[model samples]
Target: MFKKKVVSLALVITILLLSIIGCTSPQAQKQEENVLEQEWKEVIASAKGTEVNFYMWGGSRTINQWVKGYVAKNLKEKYDITLNMVPMDATDFVNKLLGEKQIGKKEGTIDLLWINGENFKTAMDNELLFGPFADNLPNYNRYMNTDSKQITTDFGFPTKGYEAPYSKAQFIFIYDQNKIEKAPYSFEELIAWVKSHPGKFTYPALPDFTGSAFVRHVIYEITGGYEQYYNLEDEAEIRKKIRPALEFLADLEPYLWREGETYPSTIAQLDNMFADGEVLMSMGYDPSKATSEIVKGTYPDSARTFVLESGTISNTNFLAIPFNSPNKAGALVVANFLESFEAQLSKYNPENWGALPVFSYDKLNDQEKEELADLDLGIATLSQEVLDKHSVPELPADLVPIIEDEWNKIVGK
Candidate 1:
């Protein structure tokens, strides 16, 4: 009878153990999966009918129209989300975010931000951004080549899923074929060209995006190369490395427009001067800008784009959400939609924004591929083959501000 009791007790313990195992195994996994799905659904539901304030550079009318007209319309119609386009410089927005953080403001007005490079680094370093959310976007997973270094890194800093690529840009110099028979294809030739054509060439003042890029390009050409500065963190070492480029600029000052005593305050001013025949050369961060301006009657028919023989800096711009954004779900919805085929194609249209598409060709469907192939990229635009052959990565983000500051103290003075 004791043996029977012992067997019965063993059977009861075995049944209880089995029950516990069942509860802790597949059942628990199913419960977790259900919770995730419910969370995603809740996000979608919350996003509906909410407004997302998108803060970005409002300098370009075309870009602003693309956002306010096409993007806003699409978001409203498709997702019931209102995209409020807020025109603010990235630096100003960063300052504003810093202020909010100082006050312990948990909810910020900025939902989406168009940012890249140093500004992105500043925001990320300050814990001001709201992601790891780029992977959550369906279009990003479907169309983006996340493995590509250009997409994965910004200014030599790892993106780590904090930002989604919005567009690609390459630095190119624009010159009038009518004024000069052949464009200079190297830094040495550029200096000689500027010397020969005294008071005819000058970049915009420092802090202007294109002007700053041009300086970096000069540094890349004059000071060894771009690769060395990618991992080197010593500020003094960097300042020493880029000194030749600054000295070169100082040497070239005499031949520059207005004798380099003053420079056009903005790229647009430089473009205008070039258009008005006051300057023979102007540079732009956008490869398509020259062509687009030509079409708009802002540039002469003789305007042409060219890159240096060594290569020009090319980088991808990205969109990011701030950590304290009031409408994270709405921002995600907009970001996902921006990566869609239709929106990308629209943005690629020179008439719309003239921004290059960030979509991977292999990932696109056959119809989408054909559509991209058939699009006219304008007569002034360089072929993708040519652009790719002469493209180089940008300098590290940390080094950029140092370069700018040094330029201000040395060259800009």
Candidate 2:
């Protein structure tokens, strides 16, 4: 009877060991991998016929038209995806996301956002965005300049696949060649030009994106270069470093339009002033903006765009998914399509959008290369070669707000 009991116990132990092996076996691991692949396939399949809500700034009619007419139509026909464009300011959207996070809402309406710079940093820091998923997109993998610092960094913050490059832009000053014999090519020249032609030049007020960028351009030109501030963390140190730029702006106060007592409240107002001959010059973040404005009859046909000798600031804009986005797969599809050669080419056309492409030239095929090279970027717009040659890196994301605040205190006072 004792022998029989011992044999029974040994048999039970053997069975338990076999069960443990089965649970962790190679076959079991393969099965788990298969399940994950199946789920990914389901995500793609589910994306079909789904509506993707894209939230972006709605101030530009041209951009809105491009989305509604071109982007929306293409998505529907190709992927059976509906593009529901929602116009919302980035700050407002960030606040909305924060509110949603506070209330613990897991499903959000915003599938994709047109975001970059400090706003992107804010979303990332608050854990309000989704994924290191940019690498997973086939187009991004094929066409992007993954090694380029401009593509990987957003205002000095590493993107880390949190955002996908959508477009490239540079700050350019616009002047009617008919009105001025020569445009200034440096910040010192700009001050002299403003002084010589008092009441004919002024920038939009503080906090306006373009105006803020113009201030940064001045700061970069005067504070030696942008390299020193790349790793600088102290706000006070930054203020001290940029004090000269602020002082220069204040010194130019007597020469600005309305003697700088009041300035144009928005870029549009400044642009209109330029158009109506109220101001001799206007500036924009878009290099092709002057050309588009001329075509739209807002500016004279002689209006031309130029960057300063110190090189104007340039950066890549990006698209990102919200953390609780309801249609992640669809958003991915839209983003992937946007980065494709076809979409980028369309965007590059001056009549369509005139936004610069994000694709690397070497990665493109011969036919694509030929087509892109042959495409006209408009007469008033500077060539890509010129823009690249004169490009300056944007200041760090944190430094931007600090600069804006200081401008408000000193220049805005």
Candidate 3:
């Protein structure tokens, strides 16, 4: 009787141990929540009472209000940190940081910033950005590691965990569906459209993101392949190969733009022109811009998005902290919140904001996805599959200027 009781007790102990192990296993818990809690506490402890000043493009009133609301509500409630959104254009942010460096301001006024592509690359090259701290972030795993193109790379600048990607956008061709239901399906067709409808299509002036992206749009098409375009960063090779593209643009220029003498100052200007009936179409980095703008009373209700048959470049923008930031922990909290599923969903709702969510769809639940489906989504719903099928040209920093200068010379603007 004693031996039977001892054996029974041992069996129960073994079962309990197995149950505990199984419960904590990767397949069982569905998340590594333990690590997150530990890291969150550590981050909070390190950044207890600091305020982070976030600088970003503040052109849109709706986006500014959205930022204000998110910062005021969540950061205070959860982290007891204050976030101040410093509205500065991208160029100004870079210029300020460069000036600080020149004057030896080790700790500058700028704490956190939103940047990507050329701006992010310039900051990284100049060593104006802060830590290799992204991997240490508590919610880092919620994102695909820095290896994912959207997370790891910026304008061919490898992030090296320096920046956290917040959202995705793409340079898409825009047109009126009512006047022209059959959008141009090829670059050749686009050229044909310009010839068919002279003075109807135009991109913003040089140095503008939309216009620069339009230059890249042409580069990706004439290069014959996406991989080749990404790989050919050599200055001489780029100039030589891109000549055909420049020629194409130069030829298309006379027919475009009013008198082909002056161009709209910015994509926003181009959008305004389109709204005023000066142009039939405008360019946008955000494929959903038509819907988002129309909802906000910026663009006409009839506007829509389209893609050339060869496709356009899709890129992700990111948030980063300066090395001299006074509120490192607060910045982390803000960046993490921006990447959270809740924030992303709110951003993707066309009626709400319509910014593209960078989070992979596989990571989201059925309920979350259903919300996306139920959204009064924009008319220009480019399926993720179709978007993934498109090309994303990662040009070398040097070549950006070459294309822009040529664009200027072509338009004489």
Candidate 4:
């Protein structure tokens, strides 16, 4: 009886000690996690009635409408949160974050950020983001395939929960089927098509994201594959490894539109060239862009998109919180909401935004799977099955500048 009393006293003391140091029993932690106690519930409570400033590229009218209309309305009605979207270029907002970081400002205007690829790398490198928070989000924990490579990395850099994926995007070459019956299925075939049809094919110049991606695809084909460069950090080595791609580009220049003297400065210009029949093909990172353009009447009904047989590059755009956000809790709430099934579904619909959802088919409930199946991806868009089978990962963010700069040198020479 006395030994049992001593054991009980010892247990009580250990529990008291754990509580004092903010530690808890494993069972207690599990119980707390099951209910989303202080960790998430408190965040939601703190977030209510606060305004979250969302800074993003507002280039698309439809994206802006979805944000200001659907997203904002839902937040207001359900969460009692006000979402303020600030329309700005990615570069401009990144600069704003840099400025704030330099001044050591503890509270800033930006609560959430929309960025991906090199920009995400820059933000993370500068410590301008507020996370590891994505893993803590309720929707992220429930519906996200946290283990998937697509969500774990951004442009080959480990995300580590600094951001949550907003949507899936893949590179596709767009062509008018009425003009060309068959789309090229490989870089060699594409090169042959370009040579056969002189002055009918051209990509936007270097430094343009789409043009840079096109160049990267060429490098991937010429340099063997993308796996070797995963750990390759040296710029000079990358330059040497990709020299063949540079030469290949230079050699192909003579067959390009305008005899390789110049290229379109922007993707919009390339699309215009395609529309006017000056160019036979255009390309975009957005998988559904071809369909959206077709819907806009910019391309004929026969216009369509396709990936190369060897696959094309793909990436995830992400939402992040600024490090010094005035409303960190609210930002977290909003970011969580963006990753919710309803928001992802709305964003996937063609009439809405047409961006692809990030959730895996297996991760979604049967109802969610049904909803996703019911929605059409539109005629001009490539089927999701084809896209998944042929998807390639993006080059690491650090390597992009080397490739882009080298291509510029090749162009200049």
Candidate No. with top TM-score: 4
TM-scores, one per candidate:
0.76, 0.78, 0.75, 0.81
Assess candidate 4 and give its lDDT: 0.85
Q: Is candidate 3 or candidate 4 better by lDDT?
A: 4
Each prediction's Cα lDDT score? 0.85, 0.85, 0.72, 0.85
Per-residue lDDT over 45-91 for candidate 2, one digit per residue giving the tens place of the 0 to 100 score: 65788899999999989889999889999999988999999999999
Candidate 4 vs. true structure, TM-score = 0.81
lDDT of 3 by residue, 292-406 (tens): 6777787666777877766687778888987556556667778887887778777776655667777766555788667656766666666554664564645655568887876
Residue 2 of model 3, lDDT score:
100
The worst-scoring run of ten residues by lDDT in candidate 3 lies at 27-36
Q: Give residue 306's lDDT in candidate 2 (0 to 100).
A: 80
Regions more than 4 Å wrong, model 1: 1-51, 58-61, 87-109, 186-200, 205-208, 250-269, 276-279, 360-366, 383-389, 404-413
Error of 4 at 323 (Å): 2.5
Q: Clashes in candidate 1: how many?
A: 0
